[model samples]
Target: MNQENNIVTRLGLCQRIEQLPQVDIGHYPTPLEPCPRLSEALGGPRIYIKREDCSGVAFGGNKIRQLTFTIGEAIHQNADTIVHGATTQSNHCRQAAAVAAQLGLKCYLRLSRDHKSLVQGNLLLDHLAGADVELVDAPFGPELDLVKYALADKLRSDGLRPYVIAAPQSTALAAVAFSWCIAEIHKQQQEMGIEADLIYAGSAGGTQAGLILGSKALGMKLQPVGVAPIYWEDKIDRIRQAANNAAKLLNLDFQIADDEISNTDAYIGQAYGVLTPECIQALKIVAQMEGIFLDPVYTSKAFAGLIDHIRKGKISSDQTVIFLHTGGTPALFAYNQELTDVPI
Candidate 1:
């Protein structure tokens, strides 16, 4: 951490986001509560869960923090409509649509034909929000950049001022939201007398970048280990670059060096959206032990990574670990078939 940069200089994304005329849509300082059961299970460190899952949207998850900024950008651009490209169980899409509805913007969702159903979880919430749905049978690629470009083109043809909530692949805005979150975590830890040696969370990469930049900016002592639930090692660099840009947005003068960012591809399991047994077992243990529900796609996988770290002694019992509950609770329902035999 740079001592000179740590001075109370009015620099970084916090300054930039504060400059924006923003509205209050989500709750703040989400509970940083202890998880006794999970801590005991880890057998080494005192484990705490940052309850972003209780963010209180249609179904709360960590996306609310990011959505706050994303929607603010949409409003800033004076977009009358909201457009997004998402997976079938995308919590981002659900929260984006919810924000669009609350802001009185026409919401357009483009999903892959790979969707399994419409009855449960995030897809149901998308319908409940009354978003205009476009199902791209096979022409749409899974890459968000492609979907964003296609949606932008379609919106232009239809004569609507559409705002694609620029995914992390496109901009630093999403990570900027989580950077603010890291600031909050720093404050919360001091208030609670807790020192986290390791912080684990699901990463498409941007979230980790934001956490790392914010921690570095505030000069907090913790390792921001990004457990990649997707296979995009190359994008981690882009994510860090986005964090630097986000730091510029916040007016913070800190830089994220290549060595500062740590990511693990092992947590991803078979592939994106495919649930592994490790994830399944971890999810069940957390729920049964602490009565906390983690969605299969994101949080469970991250938790699995944390557990592996504990088992491998990468993190010791003397250390304190914080697992970020980057809210994907809605996606849990979408994976209902996988959880059928698992007890509540």
Candidate 2:
């Protein structure tokens, strides 16, 4: 590790990651807390939580880390406006809006869902942040890209240079943000003398990708396990590709193998954003026992999978696990109607 640059050039990643123009948008080294109550509830296999939910940006979330780099790129390019697209209650959109507001850049978000649902949670934050939000007729997919480009073109025509931060294919910059975290986590584990066996989360690929690449580059024994809440099929391959892509961006030789990228889709019951019984139970368990509020969509489902693994003895009684709380607590209100019927 190069102490001066904070880049572990031995792996060839942190150097390039440091070279990128990034701003500090999130509270780093989020608190790592031991979850004794939840651990005993599962009967064994001690569990710890990475509290990214307190990242300290407009309700806090993992997206703030990603935006720190991507938004930095916008400033590096001297862009006056930024554009993004997502579902109605996207944590990413909310964080992007907050970052843009903080940085004094004009921001716009094209959302797929309308605000028929209560104007609360992330949606309300997006509005409060003063982002120019537009409701799109199409769903969030390849089609949304067309609308975003059109909006950017319109902005260009109106004499403003716009930066589009939604790059599904190019995740190197976003991936680098989490890559540094892998090093932070390794240090935390070492300093605390905790030998965690598994580190899991609800992955959209970027976070899992960077961790997978970082684990290999840094030779960490524990790789990331992603609970896919989307892309029910081919999710692992997608994550593998994302890891490789990130490595390419960093000029690193690190490659995440098939088995190295661990994930499961059993908890993605129903569909995206549709709360399941296990999700509700996991949310209730963490909130009631630990006073930690997990969003209904991502962390809850991932934690449910972790719980399922423990209950089925897949995680064994002797092991320790870490659950990455990638924060979407603001989305809880968006699903208040559904959760009201979940029986706590």
Candidate 3:
């Protein structure tokens, strides 16, 4: 498809999703700032950072886009309560609690022992926002997922309506918000006269899914790169599934293939939530060079991959690239002890 047709079809996709129930919450068209110093430091492609961090919710994130549709649907269904089961200090759950408070809906969070104590970072924010947080001894598995559902059931037994914002695999509602985001990105890049050969971001699969599907629709040869902050059993498979799920949701007649999905599990070091030396070093580079803060977990890991790719000649010097800054800055405080050795 040509640029005009691409824009038209992209708008059509956006309109179709607009017809679905949604609530307005985020600050749109988040600044796409050039990373000159960081780019010079890497001596690679010119880099631009998509500031999803300024999304303007409980500190903004890529999840705000997802929750706008997710909670919007809950509102459409007249749900009085919201439940989220996740690892301790979940950026998602923290924002969920903030959204519930803003919308006057009850919020419940089930956090595991992954982060040790619940009195810090996003957990503290969740508590202040009046979320009914339960710190359970649940391991990261199906049992924890069930624990969230059980909470919803209990609410139902008490004659209350509850909606569970499960993982992205549970539904394509979150994908809808991000599909709109890709359309926005395309417009921004067009106006800026830039072509992003590779777009890098921390991959949970869902957000990457929407970006790739949206990029495909807009006829941009943009490669959406997924950096595994933590290991998944089958990372690319999950991302491809998310892309297909998005296509199904948008009713777009396109198959998302594996070749279009670019990702790597090489950066996941210790595991989920455990930051590696490369990640910490990357965080310092961005902070020191560009005066921009990056969380120790997701964005740092993805950016570490970006830097490594540049260092390894994976990205050519003349190519244009972008790092999708999915926010998690609050989590930095949670890792104070581990980050103490890194210079401020």
The best candidate by lDDT is 3
Model 1: runs farther than 4 Å from truth? 1-16, 115-118, 138-148, 168-171, 341-344
- C-alpha TM-score for every candidate: 0.91, 0.93, 0.95
Instruction: Encode model 1's per-residue lDDT on 31-129: one tens digit a residue.
Output: 898998778876878988898888777777777777777777778778798888667777888888898888798998887766554656888889899
Q: What value does the lDDT take at residue 187 in candidate 3?
A: 78
In order, candidate lDDTs are 0.78, 0.82, 0.84
User: Clashes in candidate 2: how many?
Assistant: 0
| Model 2: worst 10 consecutive residues (lDDT sum) | 1-10
- Compose the digit string of candidate 3's lDDT tens values, residues 60-145: 98888888888988898999999887788688888999999998999999888775464888889999999999888887557788
In model 1, the Cα lDDT at residue 254 comes to: 64
User: Candidate 1: global Cα-lDDT?
Assistant: 0.78
Task: Indicate the residue-level lDDT of 228 in model 1.
Answer: 84
Better of 2 and 3 by TM-score: 3
Indicate the residue-level lDDT of 192 in model 2.
Answer: 90
Q: List the residue pairs that clash in candidate 2.
A: none
**What ranking of all candidate models by TM-score puts the best one first?**
3, 2, 1
Q: Which 10-residue window in model 1 sums to the lowest lDDT?
A: 1-10
